[model samples]
Target chain A: MGGVITGVDLLATAVFAVSGALAAAEERNDILGFILFGTITGIGGGTLRDLLLGADSVFWLYQNEYLWVCLGASLATWFLAPQFNSLQKLLLWADAVGMALFSVLGAVKAIQLGAPAVVAIGMGVMSATFGSLIRDTFLNRTPVLLAPEIYVTAAMVGAVSYTLLAFFEVVEAIALPLAILFGFGLRACAIIFDLRLPKYGDGR
Target chain B: MGGVITGVDLLATAVFAVSGALAAAEERNDILGFILFGTITGIGGGTLRDLLLGADSVFWLYQNEYLWVCLGASLATWFLAPQFNSLQKLLLWADAVGMALFSVLGAVKAIQLGAPAVVAIGMGVMSATFGSLIRDTFLNRTPVLLAPEIYVTAAMVGAVSYTLLAFFEVVEAIALPLAILFGFGLRACAIIFDLRLPKYGDGR
Candidate 1:
């Protein structure tokens, strides 16, 4: 990867790490828990994705910067936690943005690894959801993905759309942003309209 | 690995999986939870160790038989859960057996990957502890390793012993059993005499 693209990835990862720490804080966990949550949330999904792809090494292990980024993000959040608790909705937007970026990136990575289409789809979901799932486990709570929300579905939309673009021979730059936008837009729209999936009690 | 070695590994893994499923059952969780706990507790530690050492693809993914072992062990425990729960004291012996074997195996794998001693130490502990940590996470219980009960210390002892034997060019057939004996002995001692690290709250 080039220097500029790597820089962008770093900033995006910081956002995800902060979201993770914030989630731990919401549960009133301690400092070690916050750091653990931040690191897992930041790198957990990508680690699984890379392992499956047979990439050189898990990205964070090769690059020390990611560790520092997660640690810094965790500490910063710890310091500013009291003030930010009031703006919970704002944190949701940050999480959505990170999810969009990660979800598309996952699909792109799987394509790069030459996995079959369905495997790519699975990788995409793994990339977007594994971290939060791990974080929830540590907090002893059910994962948001398993709880029936606009979670994995949003990533599926992102991955499927991205795969279609690649199928159509779109430019890398164009396809990446398009997938991110589609994922984020759908998630945002769902939140704004409270669009939840119908459950057992709902009429067919 | 040779056929005989592979057979022994599978047998040990089956015993460990049975212990994990029984642990979950004792907690009174459902069948799905039992399977989840059994599988993760059985394989996750080794997978983590492999990833860290950059070993070949995880053992479970390549070998369908390993998955079947975990599934079978989980099912068997789920059905006869009450019978096994009475054997909790004995089940701890099974865990110790798994930890001992896994620690030496992990160190050997790390050496194969050309990792240094510290990395190998990390791998050994990871192999012994990762699954139980994952299991505890799902059960919303604090991890036993985190309790500082000389658990990882015992794994490290076995790992370092294995490393020294490998360095001295000792035969693996002799060295591995010695390492396993060392670890299992430590754990059995800890459990039998109720030995634990002193805590500040214990009025020391």
Candidate 2:
């Protein structure tokens, strides 16, 4: 079970790194910028979660594998930018999968640390979204969080469902996959239909 | 000495909160945005420092006073925007002082935790500048760190000097004030003379 979870985590990190590298490529940043953006986006969300939870050490400080994965993903994207142009839909699906996994895993970690359910859910959403937020912010682009999209809402759904399942004593193997699928399903629907949440003052 | 440090920390938090509120005002954000911006900016840097150091609890989590100070500062800025318009120079000076103090104090905290000198200096610079970086990023504005100004350099000077001084066994009473003044002097000069670092590709 732990092995499965770790695998998912690394895969998620790699996918996020690819997204970040693509963003840097779009900005015409140098190779150094690509690596920096990739590494930061890969590690940013988990770093924030661990810190807020007062973990003994940030996950990447002790485990170098994540860093290598990020670097590899970044270099691949940098050298193959043209190829990625045709993989946009595939990238979006991968991102959705990553977000779903991160949201559930983040909540599980927070719950293990004895955080309240609400705080755990918040951590989950943060863990799923903060890397992109950091990447966009550093690039001087408006963050996706500020957009009227169903992104964070999907993460929240995963978190809330997982927390509730845990509270009800559901086994991890069962609950984790269910929550991830639920979250990914919502995100996939949003992507397929170009769905958006209602904006503030939309009633007027 | 402890009391003095605490006072300075609170004052810096308040000053940074005011800056964040003013930024929100400039963006025409509502009152909720004002409070959220102020609170996040006030707490962001120190929280990052504490998390990086693996502190048992983040500084603001155990201390509610910081939150109140941010709230007060934000409300004051919101209601007195007109008054602040004429006090831009004063605000800049205050911000400079806050940056200088935070840089030294952040390094001191890292040193006390037995962090390496280089890491200590990095922490100091992070503590001084990250809040503003976060504020600018959330508001979709280019961060001042990228503006070729002497902003972060000033913080680095303070951190590096303080670390060097501490290594030479200088007493806190002297080292703290001297480092703060050194950093503030550099920033003040930059502000007064419109100094800038040479930009990449500027020679061409």
Candidate 3:
């Protein structure tokens, strides 16, 4: 179980790092910018969650593998972005998987830490989305959280489902996969159908 | 001495909150946006510092007063912004003071936690400037840190000086005020003289 979770975590981090590198490329930033963007995007969400939960040590400070993955993903993106016309589509699917897993994992951590269910759910959503938020912010773009997209909503649903399942004493192996699938399915539907939340005041 | 530090901390938080509210106003955000911006700006930097230092509890989490101050400042700005033509200038001065004090205080916290001097100085700079960076990101504006302005340079100088002073066994009373004054003086000069860092590539 631990091995599976760690694998998913690294995959998520790598996917997010690639997205960040792409953003840096779009902005014509140098290699330093690509690394900076990639590192933050890979780690920012979990870092924020750890800080909020008062973890003993931030996850990446001790485990250097995460940093290496981010760096590798960034360099790969920088060198290969020009040839990858379908990269955006690939990224969207990978991001959906990442978001699903992160939301469940974040909520699980918060629950273990004795955070209230609501706060745990909030942490889950934050963990699933904050990396992208930080990435977009640093790129001087409006964050996806502020958009009417179904992104955070998908994470929220996953988090809420996991918290409820845990409250019912559901087994970890079953609950984790179920919750992630639920979130990813929702996100996939949103992507395929171009679904969005209602805008403010009849689309103004 | 503790009371004095607490007072300065609250004042800095309030000042930063007001700056955030003003930013919300500039963007024509509603009252909720004002509160969100204000609260994050007031607490973001300290939160980041505490997380990095592995503090047992985030400062604002234990003290409800900080949240109140942020809320009050946001409400005040929402109501009073329309009538204040000089609010921008007032905010600039207040932000300078806040930045100066935060840089010193953040370094003090890091040193007390036994962080290495270089990391302590980094914490100080992060504590002073991250709130504004978060705000600018949310506002979709180029962060002040990314600009050619001398904003971060002032904070860096203040943090470095404080760390160095502490290393030399300077007393808190003398070291604190002097570091802040040096930082604030430099910021004031930048504001007055339109000082800027050299842009990339000899002005393109």
Q: CA lDDT of each candidate? A: 0.72, 0.79, 0.80
Candidate 1 structure quality by residue, lDDT tens digits, A1-204:
345446656776787788888876666555544665676688777777888788766776546687678879987887776665353575577677777777877887788777778887777777887777776676566666665557778888888888889889898778877887898888888778766777678885
Candidate 3 residue spans exceeding 4 A from truth:
A1-11, A14-44, A47-90, A115-122, A134-204, B1-40, B51-97, B110-126, B137-140, B145-204
Q: What is the CAPRI rating of model 3's predicted complex?
A: incorrect
Q: Poorest 10 consecutive residues of model 3 chain A by lDDT?
A: A195-204
For model 2, which pairs clash? Answer: none
TM-score for the A chain of candidate 3: 0.90
Model 3 alpha-carbon miss at residue A29, Å = 11
List TM-score per model, in order: 0.62, 0.61, 0.61
Candidate 1 vs candidate 2: which has greater TM-score?
1
Model 3, A9-29: lDDT tens digits are 788788888888877877889
The 10 consecutive residues of candidate 1 chain B with the worst lDDT sum are: B195-204
Candidate 3 local lDDT, B15-125, one digit each (tens)? 889888777666656564566678778878888887777778677654668877988998898777777776557667767877888888889888888889988889889
User: What does fnat come to for each candidate?
Assistant: 0.09, 0.23, 0.23
- lDDT for B158 (candidate 3): 92
Q: DockQ of every model listed?
A: 0.12, 0.15, 0.16
Candidate 2, what DockQ?
Answer: 0.15
Alpha-carbon shift of residue B82 in model 3 (angstroms): 8.3
Clashes (backbone N, CA, C under 3 Å), per candidate, total 0, 0, 0
